[model samples]
Target: MTNPADVKVAVVGAGGKMGTRVSNNFAKSDYQASYVETSPAAAERVKDAGRELTDLETAVSGADVIVLAVPDIALGPVTETIAPMLQQGSIVITLDPAAAYAGLLKTIDGVAYLCAHPCHPSVFLERTSPEQWADTFGGQAAPQEVVAARQSGTDAQQALGDEVIRCMYGPVIDVHWVTVKQLAQLEPTLVETVGCMVGQFLKDVMDHAINEVGIPEPAVKAIFYGHVYIALTNALRGSNPFSDACLLAMDYGREAVIKDDWARIWDDEDLDRVLAKMLRLEKIER
Candidate 1:
């Protein structure tokens, strides 16, 4: 019988944004954890958080799981330095799938590469407490789901990674397993390419109404906010059907705003191009 408490976990870049969040959760878990950060400022942050810092080599030497919470662009060099030091059968968890999907991470022979991403609190989450409502990014009071991918590992390794993933992102609803490529498609493709662009476009159009059309800000906000909520509910959950006039207007808006080839973002070549831009690489090998 394996005791999870015996598992040594190392969080690289422990004082970074994602690193700090997970390290805070790991503080409350049973696993033996190490915080490693090379930046003097970040190291000071770790100390301020009451966590002792360990050297990178020493941290990866005996770690059962190594969480690289560093940014996507830094994943290559960070993992390259730590890969040789990783213990056999150790799991290297990246916070995002971009580097992994682009084949930028240094490969270790017997080590597993797992990428686990937080979905954050959903728009439709039934948040009750003030704390839950305040935790828009989750890993706090609000419950959220995680999407994970194991690029290389056994079933047992994935199961262990799942446990670690859940612990790092506490108050998690579930962990949905997918391949690294699928996870990449879900993130930069589905979330950033489509969702975030639409969100920003809404702001752009709203500003256009206020600035260009000379609509009063308060009037525009009151009507637009209400309609946005209703639009989401009606379109996503079918809570109510759009009126015939509203449908016609929506069709006009769609034709006017969206490109005919907008769905091309889902294509693999486009995804690779997007990832290359994000990772600051000339091209993605895989």
Candidate 2:
């Protein structure tokens, strides 16, 4: 086992959103960590956090893991520059799977490529403190799961990669291993496309009800919030059998709101299409 003290981890673009979140945990960890950023604004943020920023080359030198915490669109050019400079057996960790799955990340024979995304704090989390309640995004107080993929390199490299992953995303409950393609699918397809879209759609319709339909806002929200929990528990957990009338209403709602061929989002072509749009690329090649 590689000791955490011996592991040299460098976070590139160390002042961005995801960068700052993970850097907070790494700062409290035993791993020797380096922060790197080129933008003056970001570099100042790093400095304000009392972390000395290292230049890209100095930070990547002999580093066991180089975390590219930059944006998805920047991954191709960023990896093109950094991947070849990595020492043998180093692992490159990306926070998102889009670029890695789309083949935008550069490849090197001896270096491992990994993508790890946090699942965030669950709605069902058993929170007992103000801190946990405030940490809806996890990594601070609330425990969360992670989904990760190792795209290359040996078992030892992966083990160390796992350690770094758990460290940076501390308070993590579990790390579910999946293929790079599977990780990509879980993200934009399952979570963003379906889950987030549904959430936003709910808010939109709620607004329509209160504003256009002339329903009382307090009454609508009172019924909606409570029913939301019951609906999820009944459908997802089978906590209680939905009344027969409720089932008919649900069936009608499904037919009215959901398309018959909505499952086509699972198709690989559709995944590639969405990934391209998300990454602002012409198309994902493969």
Candidate 3:
């Protein structure tokens, strides 16, 4: 039997928003986590969230499972850095499953990789508390009706993924799985759509709060609804079809809408200052 308790998780983006949430959830869950954030402040935050801290090499080298919580653009380099560091037989998991990343992950030898959630929960307005998110977006099982559809149309693994549609989001739902072959073709559009909507909404919030600068509220609601609903549906569609093309296409569309230049609205020199102000986050660079 697989011992769920034996899982030793290492989170690579412990200092960021999504990393913190993932660290917190894992802390509350039964698994053990070695939280990794390059920033000491982010590392400290992970410790405060009740997880341990370690550098990239040490974390992946000793971990049974490694979770990359970094931004989508950073995944390629980050994964390449850690691939050689990982212990034999260790499994790697990426929150975003875009084809570019999935293709990169497949290049790693002797490690298992899985593409799970495409979007982070903070995008949802309803997710005010970690508990609310834990309860609502936790996990789910796919419906039976989709089973036969998958069986005749695809392979067993593909059908199994289809069976997990129901549990895609709550404590009532369980974790879903898909192969690298499948994940590679999917995930891009889903991440792009979700990330773009959140970015745009955040942009709007920042614009309205230019005077307040850091304290944003209200508009965060629309951001969450539009972002999460769109992402979840795409995830379901991709993971169920056991194909990644549709999701990739969506990501392409979203990227075309808002590329990194969006960060330019705030001058480059003051970008850090702007982010600190908008998120009410204290700069922890020591």
Candidate 4:
């Protein structure tokens, strides 16, 4: 395993969103880090953050780990450009699994590829500080979990990837290792498709309640926010038995709002279909 403090790390899109976050963490760590950005505005952000920017070739060459923190659409070309220059046994990490799972990354025979996505602090995480409570996205003050996939690597290479994953997305609690396909399924399929969609739908319902039903905005927010917490706890954890009336209402709501075939989204074909749309591909190739 690579020593965390001695590893040479490079951030390819150091001026972007995920890039900035991971770069900030690395800046505060002991690892030797290089920040590379192509955009003028983003390059300014990186320099303004007190990070010295390096050229792509200079940053990637001989690096122990190279992080492609660019957008999913650019990952293919970015990897194609940089993968061949990497040192042997070096790990290339992406912040998301979509590009890797959809066969969008350029692979090198001796170079390892890994993808790690932050689980973003759970809603149920118990917090003791204002900072933790305010850091809803994790990687700042709150502790969070990470789901990662090592597409090509030995156990030691995987360990090195995990070590860097923890540093980049630090204050981390655990790292759950899974296959690239499994990671993709948990992301766009389970989380974005169902979980995030439901969260937004609830917001739309609340807006409708206030605007169309003429409910007072303050009163609607008060009840809806509290009920959202209760609903999640009861449904997810069975924290307490829900009342019979509540259960009956839930059943009615589910029947009215959800199709019986919604579970098909979990199927392998459906996963590929959604992933294709996400990656802007005609179809995923194996």
Can you give the TM-score per candidate against the true fold? 0.96, 0.97, 0.50, 0.98
Question: What does candidate 1's lDDT look like per residue over 8-94, in tens digits?
Answer: 999999999999999999998888999999899999999999999999999999899999999899999998888779899999999
- C-alpha displacement of 111 in model 1, angstroms? 1.0
lDDT of 3 at 9: 71
Q: Specify the poorest-scoring 10-residue window by lDDT in model 4.
A: 1-10
Listing every candidate in turn, what is its Cα RMSD in Å to the true structure after a full C-alpha superposition?
1.4, 1.1, 13.1, 1.0
Highest TM-score among the candidates is held by which one?
A: 4
Candidates in descending TM-score order? 4, 2, 1, 3
Off by over 4 Å in 2: none
Q: In lDDT terms, which candidate is top?
A: 4
Give lDDT: candidate 3, residue 66.
72
Model 4, span 84-177: residue lDDT tens: 6899989999999999988989999888899999999999999989999999988999999999998998888899899999999999999999
Per-residue CA lDDT of candidate 2, range 16-84, in tens? 998898899999988999999989999999999999999899889768899999999999999899865
- What's model 3's overall lDDT? 0.53
What TM-score should be assigned to candidate 3?
0.50
TM-score winner between 1 and 4, please give it.
4
Show the colliding residue pairs in model 4.
none
Better of 2 and 3 by lDDT: 2
Name the Cα RMSD for model 4. 1.0
Q: Which scores better on TM-score, 1 or 2?
A: 2
- Error (Å) of candidate 1 at residue 51 is 1.2
Q: Report how far off residue 227 is in candidate 1 (Å).
A: 1.7
